[model samples]
Target chain A: MTITVAIDCMGGDHGPAVTVPAALAFVRDTPDASVVLVGQEDVLRKYVGAADLPRVTLRHASQIIGMDESPSLALRNKKDSSMRVAIDLVRHGEADACVSAGNTGALMAISRFVLKMLPGIDRPAICASLPTQSGHTHVLDLGANVDCSPEHLLQFGIMGASLVGAIEHNDRPTVGILNIGEEEIKGNDVVKRAADLLRDSGLNFIGNVEGDGLYKGEAEVVVCDGFVGNVALKTSEGLAQMLAFFLRQEFGRNMLTRLIAVLALPVLKRFKNRLDHRRYNGACLLGLKGIVVKSHGSADAFSYGFAIARAADAVRTGVLARIAERVAQGQTQPEPA
Target chain B: MTITVAIDCMGGDHGPAVTVPAALAFVRDTPDASVVLVGQEDVLRKYVGAADLPRVTLRHASQIIGMDESPSLALRNKKDSSMRVAIDLVRHGEADACVSAGNTGALMAISRFVLKMLPGIDRPAICASLPTQSGHTHVLDLGANVDCSPEHLLQFGIMGASLVGAIEHNDRPTVGILNIGEEEIKGNDVVKRAADLLRDSGLNFIGNVEGDGLYKGEAEVVVCDGFVGNVALKTSEGLAQMLAFFLRQEFGRNMLTRLIAVLALPVLKRFKNRLDHRRYNGACLLGLKGIVVKSHGSADAFSYGFAIARAADAVRTGVLARIAERVAQGQTQPEPA
Candidate 1:
């Protein structure tokens, strides 16, 4: 029942500077959890403070994956890299879960290659938790398999539903296929096929959800292929930033405008955070054999710490075991021919 | 030159309620411009006042295309419909340009079929005026062709550049292709091919632009496939709405926040309008033989008027004719194999 969290200490923009301290904070904050910081020992010590003195085990690794390095090459060449070693620890039962903010492609590939997928899972889906107007919604297949089959989308729905149930505490969370329109006959072949499969499945399929649905909590779980999902997610981020930038420009137009902006500081800050990408930094690589969390590479300490808690919650809820059992039991409802 | 604008009075959510008054106001304000209101006479007169109506003509039509009607079917069945008749006016030299807030798909198809594409133009692109931090950026192929080839994208870039030059007064605006990354070697096959094509073209091609660049004013013209453009545009709209919704929620959370919101009202209003899609509602169907403008279906009177102005601007600049000349001259720059 002991919770051991493996951390990729040399992964993000700040590398060990942010990752090592955050790992120590997580171990200190969570009484029942033990942390294994994966990186070169000499570098890890440089960032860790005296007060944070090696309370956690330091695992040595010779290589560090660059942020822009090719995903496959980084994983293949740097076999003992922090990212791969951390996932490997989870695969060998040395860690309860693995966390990294490295190159998303590398982390996803390494996790899938090392721990493998759960039974009935075609591929590992990346599910990001979005802070919606209503509450929180799970958006999946962010960039795992750019080209996905209807079956893969259906699996995404099931895994997303399961993850939301365990993490967000939404029982039987509604599942939706992202589409250009809500009609059953709307989207492309891929979307139509996914909708058909979802309809047949006994999961609480809520039909199609558009891009707006992701932020308004139109459904608890929104599923799509990696290509569409990646575009949708990045586009949303670009838009939020754009609006914020526009607000700043309008406010700086004149002296009176600057005064007005000062008065609305509190309200604007709240709005900024509500629409902030930083708040939705952590993502879960679901349908895998073990829990593997991925945070935004540019995430600060607060969000990085939150990712640790997210990972711990998933492990405690037995999310992976439940998915494996359901997948192994072959109880998925079949679509009519 | 007579700046006659033919409006499909049957289009839009409110239709004549928004379009008629807007047209009346435009005639009153502009003084020199003329308008031809194409729709059922009864519906048209109900919205437009007979007295003091300066240079306004109402053309009767028997059919109207509903939002849910199939694009091809509407064009075939509703031959003398308001939308069709309006475009016909431009085709037959009775009007300088045409405007419709109707079904976008139908408009693109009908315009291509009726007016025909300019010579040398492989594909016609839809160009929408978008408000950016710097001012306004022209984004094209917003939703005209969902599935596109590298060649089609190259056409979009060329057409978008020409449209921006005519409408925005940029002689040779900076052009950039939308992609996942900015590097020349980055993105899928389609993007790399388009980049090679653009580079050889000797247009002020600025290479690739990421999602974040759309609102940052990285380039005056941002060209993308219809599928990606549609998602990007819709995602931006959804995110802006979501941010505003969340801001209102936060403002109403407490009394102090509400007071702060009131004090910030002036700057907030400016900020809101800066991101208002309505201001940039109209999109020109570029590469066609005649000028055709499409406005948002949900636009109000003010938005409809702005759309009319947009249509007039395109006609005044002879943008369509210039595009046709470029195509006819076979002036396309060859790309490296």
Candidate 2:
């Protein structure tokens, strides 16, 4: 199966400098995959180089959305934006999937507006893989729906499970509700109701998992409302950044510590590599009719390639089909309000 | 003023083995402070030694509350538990504050039931200081109230500011609402309403703060519903543990790395010291008529002593009086339902 991904080359902090190279590298690495680099032809052409790679193609897009632009404004005004054009490619079935390192809100809004929601899905959710002790766990609704209902949470569980089933090739991934405690009596009314719905659902429902369970790999897929998930995700980022800063400050404190840092550089580098955030760069915008993955807006070429690879994997593994099928089976029926 | 803190000696994972030593060490370090150890008198006497320290005393309690017991069950049945007796001492004016390394739910429930809420406050909150880039930021409502109103959040902001004022001596500490973003339009309705209330609150309101801003030290105090706060705190712990595990695994991968690890041990130890979780062990149960601090159940003597110091500091600085005065001033009037 030849998986083609539409790349928003003009998006992200580095624009074409990061996205174009990442696209070329992705195509070079995967013989069964191709990428359509969508951006201002003039700018992207300069980075595309003299060697004409058959697997890599360029599509012209006149407008570019700023990283900090309002999502609504970008969705309404920037029709020819690389982000929109990339999603348009997926909508028209020109590409199997779309990937962008653009503004998350804008990408989400534009994707929803263009490709529309998948059948039986109310709102699309942002799903991303987080590094864990055993391997990694997929967490959904990182920042999509701030106020989610129990039905929405139930939907997130189904979509998340389908995502793991497709990507990890696991038919029944352990799904858990993100709560304050693992007990049934824990959490607010919505979570309690969602737990009931999940328990009845045919998926491998593991009940409630605490915050620490996310990194402990207690479940293959952890589902939460966007507000909670976003806070958890960003808080982790903040902590990791603070720890890194402290590590650098301590190692550079004095001459004696500096000497030890020099000797320990190799081991430190290896350790850093094992926990590299780049390895988990792509965040899948799940529950959409077509596959859409959002890369970090500040991602570099090497990091952005992971996003491309994720989009390709979703396409090849038929994640969208699995979600539709799961929902169609009527296993995720919500309780009447 | 000499402050008196009642210690729940039978609480925590180690019971008297940890709490007894911690109480003794606390009185030794804090000359102006005294501790009344509440637990099985015979069991604690064995650990208290024959010194008969002038500042240390023992109060016998027949029962012990299990760490895993339900909060409501412990509150009703374990009224004679060491946890209850310690709080009772504070209620009876024998002690100015109380410290416990016990079940957090039980501590909060029992504290609220015994000490009661301060005038004009509906519910209590759990406030704890987290290490940040510049210094530290105090966050409140960490698993106390899973669901909170805008009014409750405003109360939390007020209480957190008061705690910071008492502990850090900052009367006008920058206060912020924890949200997915720093923008006015970010977060759920409660957060948005809370932001508006905070703006008119006559306090040092700094508007919305993102998760990364917590570690960046953008605000001295950040307030949120207990659900969000607890998830953020526990998620950070999980990530830190995972990173530590990864670091150890990388260093022990091969003999060459092991030699480098030995050479770099001192620097690594210093780095670890700067990021020690034990340094921020105590969490203040704010909005109560009396001061109560909860220590980590797994804390050692040195770590648990911090909780004792926290309670003593709260008493010495008159944190309870400050919060009551602030609330009595009618600065936190909630909107009618």
Candidate 3:
């Protein structure tokens, strides 16, 4: 029942301050789960004092890759950095998965380089769990590959559906191809071609889902190219922040509005709680041999804990194996030229 | 200088019920402007009784294109349809511009066919004015061509800048190439290539802006290919609607929440008004030799009136000439091979 996750303590905006406390909290909550904190020994000891929890382990990594470091530079030089070493744990069978909140480009590059891709997957896709109206919809290829062909999109769908089925226990999850319009012939050549593949892939392929469908809970797994996925993800974040800013400004405008705000503070709190991005902070890096979940770089201990929990859940549910099996099945059918 | 706009009264989800009343209201408000309502004579007269207004004119057409018809089918068969006849007004110089709330694909195809592309422009991008934190940001290629080259993106920046300059009175609008990350080396080859062209094109290139940048008002003009743009736009709409639904469900959960909702009514009203998508309707079909504006298909009288105003403003400020001139200037500079 033991599931171990390698934690990149030197990643993200807050680095060890956020990741270490989260690692402590996560292992405490999940009794059967343990975390390997990968960072410098001296710095790691500052947070994990007395080693009270037997589930906690500190693995020494010689270097640290910065939050803003270029992927090329980070991959080229920081070979022994926490981000790389943490992912190495999964590759070497020391840990079930690795969780990082570092530079996305660096993490993707290092993970792909060290762990390698699955047999049928050409490139690893960044899969993030996003909240939809009904429940959570797993969206993939967030930003791993900007220019994706139809095959890459098809692979993303396979991985996403597998992850959801294994973790959520949804045997037949609907996969939606994100397009401009819901019609079959609405998108560019790549999307149309991807649609044909998804339709015949034996999965529950729901036709095209438009941009709005991402939030409307039209599908369990929404597949798109990295460029579109990234834009949609970021745009949603930016909009949420803007809405919060506007609310604050409006409440502070005049004495009447301010007094009304006090009366409605409880409802406002409830509303804010419903839309908090942190609640859905954890996203998986799909199509890789090992399970890799990405936490938002700016995530606080609360959100980072969720990310750690997410990685552990994937390991417990055997998502990686499910994806590999599904992928192999998909690859058996010849790809259209 | 009197400006005339040809309105396709039989287009959109609401058809004549929305467009006719919207046109009448627009002419009543704008003294120097008139609208030509294009549709079957009987249907047009049903909405516009007695034709009492001197600023109004009814132009009859032989056919009406359905909303769900394919773009190719609509273009080939419905040549004398209301939508095509309305566009013909601009083509024959009978009206300064055309406004329609038709099928987006059909509208784009017909507009391009009838008006022709501006010199140096390869495609017509759908540009809409989005309300940001400060004022408004103009985004282009909403859903015209799903696949675009680097040169198309470069041209979008040029066209967007000229539109802002002519309409908003800002000579040099800051343009941001939409990408997943703000870094120079973040996006795919297409975006990277587009970034290079934008940086060297002598416009106010403000580097890359992420998805959230669209709402944060980071740039006055945000450029992306049609596929990404459409997804971003629809995702925003979907997110906003979902937020609204969640708010309603929360408020209706119990008596306390409903009481708080009553108290927070004013603030909620103000907040909704600020983020109302209706205030920012009527996206222009840019890069066309003549002007064509597309309103939301399900627009009400108030929003459709705004669409009419948008068209008149474009005609008044000479948006088409400015775009054509700037495009020619950009074309004169040797493109990077």
State every prediction's TM-score relative to the real structure. 0.94, 0.96, 0.97
Off by over 4 Å in 1: A50-55, A250-263, A329-331, A334-337, B183-186, B329-331, B334-337
lDDT rank, highest first? 2, 3, 1
Candidate 2 residue runs with Cα over 4 Å from true position:
A50-52, A332-337, B332-337
- Model 3 ranges off by over 4 Å: A50-52, A331-337, B331-337
Ordered list by DockQ, greatest first = 2, 3, 1
Q: Native-contact recovery for every candidate?
A: 0.51, 0.82, 0.87
Worst lDDT window (10 residues) for model 2 chain B? Answer: B328-337
lDDT (C-alpha) at residue B244 in model 2? 89
State the weakest 10-residue window (summed lDDT) of model 1 chain B.
Answer: B328-337
Candidate 2 backbone collisions, by pair: none
Q: Clashing residue pairs, candidate 3? A: none
Docking class of 2: high
| Chain A TM-scores in order | 0.93, 0.96, 0.95
> What local lDDT does model 3 show for residue B235?
93
Clashing residue pairs in candidate 1, if any?
A: none
Residues B1-337 of candidate 1: C-alpha lDDT, one tens digit per residue? 6699999999988889999988888888886699999999987877876553668998998789988788889888989899999999989999989999998878988898899887777677888877666776788888777667887887887888778777667767899988766656556677788888887775688998877777778888988877667767776777777778887888888998888778777777877777777788788888888999999999999999999999988888878766765556453544324
